[model samples]
Target: MKSFEKELPENYDALKKKANYTSSWRDRLDAVTTLSAYQHEKVIDLLNNRMKNDTVFKVQTAAYKALVAFGENVEKPTPARFDVIKGPNKIFLRVKKSLPKDHTVEEFADKLKRMRLDVYDAFEGDKGDQFMTWLEERWAKL
Candidate 1:
């Protein structure tokens, strides 16, 4: 039950989704390891689910280690689901799963800059909402 020392990324919710649902166990294991680093209260709950229900043995073991790191007992987990935003939340989430996992506002801006695409004053003479729509449409193709 070694503690994870790495830091969790801001895209953690997405990564958690990736861990439990991705076909690639390597990615799932990576996601679990990253999530363990955070020790978020919900993280233990998620790890318990992973330990109990994951089809992959290594992932279950990883989750067990993570629970141990958090000083939680594996056999006595509380009934909880880590659906942090089943509807939505105080902080917005990027639920656009069709796009690349690591795409960011900075990269989006840089790409727009390189392509000379203007999110501002570019579509139907509307700036903000139109930009989001444009980005969504383009991101869907990625």
Candidate 2:
């Protein structure tokens, strides 16, 4: 029978770094997706870690799928109750309060990027190409 083991990618260290829970959820998701192609034991370990512990539901789901693809027995994780950015409305309201009455949405977006990079990054990752439009709509509602 042929061995199905695969070699780790050259950028494995970088992928590991991105797999850390502290990294943005999107980064972790990207790492999981990239690492899933390999059949190495180390790769399986990394994907299992993400499956069991990543706070983002999407990341967890991706990790679970990858593990299943590798023929690992695993249950689908329940969606995490933790919000990517806690109290996002409150955070944005604070930003809105700090700005001048006449501030444009662009200025608000800039301030959001500067003041709360976590929120900015989370929204950017979650919204993808719709980020700007979502921000604009959110800004108007605020």
lDDT of each: 0.57, 0.82
Q: Write the per-residue lDDT of candidate 2 for residues 6-77, one digit (tens) a residue.
A: 999999999999988453877889899988888799999998998887656678889998888888899999
Looking at model 2, the pairs that clash are: none
Where does candidate 1 stray beyond 4 Å? 1-9, 76-142
Q: Can you give the lDDT of residue 2 in candidate 1?
A: 54
Most lDDT-accurate candidate? 2
Per-residue lDDT of 84 in model 2: 55
**TM-score of candidate 2 relative to the true fold:** 0.68
To one decimal, what is the Cα RMSD in angstroms of model 2 from the true structure? 3.6
Q: Report the lDDT of model 1 for residue 59.
A: 72
> TM-scores of all models?
0.46, 0.68
Candidate 2: stretches off by over 4 Å? 1-11, 21-26, 40-42, 52-58, 77-83
